[model samples]
Target: MDMAETAAAVVDRQADERVRLVVTGMTCGSCSARVERALNRVDGVTATVNFATGIATVDAPRAVGPERLCGVVEDAGYEAAVQSGTAALDTGPEDRAAAALFRRLVVALVLFFPLADLSVMFATVPATRIPGWQAILLALALPIVVWSAAPLHRRALTGLRTGAMSMETLVSIGITAATAWSIVTLFARPAPVRGHGVWAAIMSADSIYLEVAGGVTVFVLAGRYFEAKAKRRAGGALRALAALGVRDVTVLTGDGREIAIPADELTVGRRFVVRPGARIATDGVVAQGFSSIDTAAMTGEATPVEAGPGAPVCGGTVSLTGRLVVTATAVGADTRLAGMIRLVEQAQEGKAGLQRLADRIAGVFVPAVLALAVLTAGGWLLAGGGTDRAFGAALAVLVIACPCALGLATPTALMVASGRGAQLGIFVKGQQALETSRTIDTVVFDKTGTVTLGEMTVSAVHTDLDRDEIVRLAGGLESASEHAVAAAVTAHARARHRELPPVTDFAALPGLGARGRVEDREVLIGSPALLDARRIAAPPGLRAALESEQRLGHTAVYLCLDDRAVAVLAVSDTVHPTAADAITRLHRLGLRTLLLTGDNTAAARAVAAEVGIDDVVAEVLPAGKVEVIRELQARGRRVAMVGDGINDGPALATADLGLAIGRGADVAIGAADIILVRDDLAAVPDAIGLAHATLRTIRGNMVWAFGYNVAALPIAVAGLLNPLLAGAAMAFSSFFVVWNSLRLREFRP
Candidate 1:
């Protein structure tokens, strides 16, 4: 992905580049779905609108511009603004929205209380009712409907213009119907007889429903206020990330002078000096000095890692105990921290299978409710009930039928879970990962860079020549290469001999080794296979050394001189500190585990045994790794493939759910469904556990939302439900669902 921090709207050139828009006026899931449908109408566009967060994440071809997408959303009866390219999600709009709703709600409540108190007084004591009380109630209700309820009414009208029926539409019509009926009854019907008692007044026109109008408006406004508040809190984790960048950084000039500059101005390749207790300006490698870096904030490692020259460090990490000079490698949105924030937001804005179903049902729900309401009114009239009774029944049906809860059932939970996960360095890429995680029976791990630390170090060396002579020749040729093994060999050589002889004609053989000329003689360094391919000779002792190193689960490389193997180097990778504990946790959760790698059988098995894995697939290339995953799946295993994401792309994509352990800034853009930014392997099990928690919350919300409509609609149709009670249920459900989702903010797993 391109560095997108320069502008508010970025049209990226990559395929399926994401464009985020802050959508306004979305009242329910149907409204969000409508925006998705409109945007999806553009070719090569896929979009998901999260009703709770009000963020619409759209992946579209570069040819289809963001303007067109925003225009499409505006055409679908909502407002749209492109979200800025920065990782920090602004809560300003949400706060403003909540304040506005609260102000309106206070006004509605002021009017609603007086109107309700008047209705209760009249109900309990009809003789105490004043002659002009209805007129006073009418005056109070007018503002509650026209001002307090204006937002819903306006959105309802917008959807109506587009021939759409949303939750807003249903709520708006119910409020209007109740208020309109009361207006007609108050003016058209004769006043009650002077001697009439409470029983007689019950059947008369004295029972106006102005309080229902005021109460519904107040309740719906409360719901909106709560929704706005939740949205403001939904991205707290990313917002913190956006704020973590230092305000200023001290840079080392070419002349060795130190000067301070804005953090964003420290571009790639710029050398900056970081003192103890200062946060690194951006992602970079230490060019000088040493320190203990507190990476716990970014990588979730409880202990500070040792950092010396050439050690990579993230921007948000703090330097402890020493000073260091770092050369920036990434800045702005291109940094790993920024990418992680974006990954979590995309998940927050995505729709799961169940949410999509709810959207479909919400789309059908409003119109079905309209028909049912009409049938209810007609049925009441046919049963010899008066027009007052029929209108009341119809009004109750309109108020009781709610789709807001259904629309919110999934995205609210996801938004909360994504934010909480982000704080723990877990980034969920999409909803499919959450759904798939609930069923995963096995986890396939890559040995290199996953079970083991992936960095190679020479453990021992066997050679006929003097140690210094062999080291100088091998390190000189390896210096020209960039492979991990070459780095290990060069570092080992440097420690033994401070300098190496200059080499000529250096050439690297991919996946094999390197060859060059040192001191007018051919020098080669690589695996034993490179020698066999070159028709070189290895004596029995050298061959036996190779076998012994491989048996010990160490990488063995041959150092050759003039087509003859002169020495062998045994290099090994350190096992990750948390691999064993992570595997044990997965097993405790009733999951099977396997290690899949391209390393030789002995090496793979050694790492597997150390990590407590039950099975190992060894000597498998990237494509062969996919075959192993497929074989496991063919055996009815739901597998989640875990890797560093650089070499395991194919296997990760083919698995049921891909959890990519983040290696650096450049990894994990699109390769995995779940990105583990933390270096600890424990996040693997934590990701799955978090997925299960989110799934359970979503399921509970779905049942309540759908079940309420199923059980309440019948009572409304039979005229057994009161409009005030129905309005309370409908209006509070949306707020209740959001409040339920907020429980995930405290989730540990």
Candidate 2:
């Protein structure tokens, strides 16, 4: 099959069996990428690792199992466990880790302040140098270096065992070497004071770096604490959504007795009762009751929807003021709330293309920095610099070249953007959509439901018979049909209080219309094609009236009696108020707009003209829509398809970027890359605007992260920066990247 055909088939295929793992000890992007690569090496497996969320989504054959995946990650020197229930959204472990780091940071700061003051006293007034002050400094710095940095040491040893290098390895090497040197200096006799030249003074001064060892540990620990906190906040939206579901619910037993049970135990075909201000237990239909439902938590819509008997309600939505007796149709993972949570989790775990570049660089970053540190030490010794100078320069290089910022640059930005998008009622499936949306040059919109309100209503009528009789006869025949246009005619009759005659021998002619005996008169209601097929003759001016209605974008249905045209009913879908302005905004963004529909030429053009669309492609079948997307792609134009129907599914999956209206069919929503939660055309432009802004943020973060490393490395190698300053700069680099990404939270689209 061709590419378009293959994409269409992909949407229909069942998803591959997958396993989600919560991985620990992933300090940088390279660590996560390493786990991902190891899992992908297993037979029949594809793995994606998200560093920001620390989750791995692996798609593997059923034969592989979760144990094998966890084993592979463990072998790669990280910890992994299968995640279930609400464990994926829990941040308790991260919070506990942060709390532990905070305690260590406080201890380090308390001891280092006095130790630093004594070092200054010894340097400024030689007579005030207390005996064994160096020993006292070493005693004070020991716990901060050994105990406060225990986690770093463990991870660093794991990297060494696996023959890999990470940010932890760099930190561990710097701290161990600096502390070991300080201990040796305290026991050995002090070097003699020399000439006042800068190099001679640096060589003659005491070579103790006790403050460097203690300060580096504290700053690195603090950086990790804040990084963990920021990551939790970035994923807070999905966690909050998962928390909205009630654990226990009041279910009405088959015997009509109410009992409390776990929400997961509520199975399909069961009945449940919800009281005022209570959340609906699961996806179900209201059997009896009336209430205003608050769907804002589930759909991001502000207004409450009215729920009555036979109305469908979703899980996690609250009932405002009335009791409801609902029959459960879906429970457990089958509920709409569960599906939305799955989508959000998958989006968080997926990686952007730019992040792959960062991962590649990070994978080699530590090893390269190690090599640079060795060269700096060797070069200093060969140039006649003392061992003190050589060791200090090497320590500075090891402490300064951090890969954390590069690792965090892209994922943090994407995390913030996805969370912000969720709040704005736009669900971005993954980073690919965010990247593709920014470059789209053309947008093709499905006219019905996407641009116009999907609801059809009877707009006008022309007939020789009385209007009441025409509506009554048409409603009788249409009552047996389930088409939208038929429903519109029947609804109009009901609203007018016109009694529908009994419909006998009702037969639905598939694509044409419906025919039946209404009060002993043969009634036919459908398109003009049905009348033509039945050899019916229209009355004078009937053709002109039908043409006029069609010209105004209304569907004209002809009612025939005994093979004679009796009346023409015009049904039209209302255009959304923001449709024209949305088109204008897209034009302002320099994107070409087209209307694609299965409606007739005149009706399609009329709506297109009304909405300010630049082009119209009408009378196209569902399969043909895919070809249109392919043809546009062939012209080097990136296309984003906006649609909201089952027929729009294939095209949506085939387009470069697919945006489905929230009220669309499940199939369309499943195939789309982005979903506009509100059925408003204005969200189309708003989504695109948000995509552009998010991409810009990602690029800006990458530039800053790369620039910092490039500029700092040389200064450390030249011994212009001391180890303590280098450590501070390294920690600040990571914090700066995260703070830059948080700016996306203020995005207003």
Candidate 3:
């Protein structure tokens, strides 16, 4: 190819090879600038950096990758790493470094105690001027500046060279200006004063302020470190979501060789072998073998499900005790695991207006402070104020306006609150969920397994002849069905181990009942309609049994023989012991609760009244539940919907915040924003409380962070403080704000 064509192709390749990097050890504008310069110098690399977000994106040749770029970043004393596009990285490392730096800086700060006393003694003792003691004091400051403050200087210079501003930018500017000014005044000859004899200048005291600058540098770096680490740790839920899918799977090749290959390359209808104790490679039916599979990771249930031929196996579920040959139905991003990862990624990247407001304030803060400082100094200088006074004002402006406090406030509290939530078996997802929960004014719950214990029990068994014979016959017919009522009847019969005669010509009528020939006698078990169609007249005793069951809101299955009323099987939904208490708790919290379900109206109303729900939407489909949520939202009510079925996906996705009990299938969890690992209704309250706490902390941090800057900037620019002292105070203030933010770790729901 010609050079022009080759260059065009290279540009196309560059556009396709975009990469992301997480860079650490950045403290000031100089640090960012340095990283930008170093990365740009590498072959075929284009990078964009947002100093506020501390995120960097690079487009480079595939051969010049993130691993290579990371080397360049680390060589400069910063840690550069790659993260998956699938999940948020943890903030653990950054938090630890911040903690370490903070601990060391505290010791350095304490050393300033003796230095302060010495300064006071020197100031108070008018006749004592020991040049030797003064020189010794200056020399003693070597450890504070070089050992303690070096990281800040290094990061600041790097950021400066790379054309970015960071916390180090202000510190470097304040410290360097003060140090140079003091050193020059100490050695240089003073310019001749007009109409006055030249006066010899004595030793300068301004240099003593460098200790403050150095101390501030160390402390500020510590804050950033913790902030970064906490951010990473708070995002652990996203990491678990990312780790759901299989990276590679066994592939049956056309050459008759069974080879392991990347899952992304697997095609639909391709058959593969799943070994025992290994996760299923893709979503497919078991083509061969019989065994139990543990789907707890995907379904969040401890039950090991039995799978036979044609049973759908989701990817990421282990085959605990069985080997099976499976056909690849879905792979890579199409698998259930990938679907969850995509959902989580969308939540992380979708920034709401409220979330971005913090950044907007931070964006304009630095430049405004810098401008104010310049104006303050010039105004004082033009009024015939001494150069020293003007410089002091300018130093205050730069030192006092640190934005680290604002940056760490909300995120730190959010991290702690989310962590506490995870410990309580609740996943808050992100800031959106936290904010949404705090705003939720109404809660809608699913009927089955949500407001109830999700189990069915035999309420009554009525028979014209022997009750045992009726139970045995009905249970034998119901044993073939997987429905709740069938399980209840089968379990009741099995408890007594009653001998059931074989039934021939069995038939199931969904949602109604079943029919079969028992011992050559046609027997039917179903609802009132089936008996009415058969024209069977019930005895007075059977009528009483039906009335009592209906009054209790139990499901009554009528039994008939030879078109005559024979027996009636009664089943009732089990109510959870905690459901009523949870409803009372919600009421106490001033929340309105309602039940939404597809169950019969009578049963729904009974459950709702029993649980103290104010309203019930009965015989409603999954979409109907979502519609109800929307109607409440339209009425200016914030709503939260909790569900655990694939049918609930739409409602779960459409609610203000969808909370899926982790006991559900992977599809359900993927649909909801928050996942409650424990199926307890109490977790709903726990999650809401945690969200409130996190939001409060976020607001608290923002107030401290922004409030500090507002109070400090004016003091800095008015020249009320010297550069050295201003730098130290500014560093300490920022550190204090961050340390306060770290207290979020102790938050509990």
What is the TM-score (0 to 1) of candidate 2? Answer: 0.90
- Which lDDT tens digits does candidate 3 get at residues 1-749? 99999999988865657666777665533344456667778877876433323455677878886788888776655677786545243445555666777766775566655654554344334345466545544554555666666766776676566455566667667666755664454335323122222121111233334444444554555455554454555555546545656778887677757898887778889988788898887888898898899876654446688998998888878898888888888876677666554443433332333435555555456666667778887988998877766776777677777666554455445544544555465665556887787788888888887778778989788876988777877777777777888899888887776576777888888767888888777878888887777677788888789877886678887788777788878898887677787788778788898899998888888888887998888898877887888898999998888888788888888889888877676767877778876557777776676677667766766676667666767666655555545555655555564455555556553
- State each model's CA lDDT, in order: 0.84, 0.85, 0.68
Worst 10 residues of 3 by lDDT: 194-203
Report the lDDT tens digits of candidate 2 across residue range 680-747. Answer: 78889989998998889889888888888899899888877778878999999899889888888788
Highest-scoring model, lDDT? 2
TM-score, candidate number 1 = 0.83
Candidate with better lDDT, 1 vs 2? 2
lDDT-better candidate, 1 vs 3: 1
- For all predictions, the C-alpha RMSD in Å is 6.3, 4.1, 8.6
Cα lDDT of model 2 overall? 0.85
In terms of lDDT, model 3 sits at 0.68
> Total clashing residue pairs per candidate?
0, 0, 24
- Pairs that clash in candidate 2: none
Descending-lDDT candidate ranking: 2, 1, 3
Error of 2 at 263 (Å): 0.6
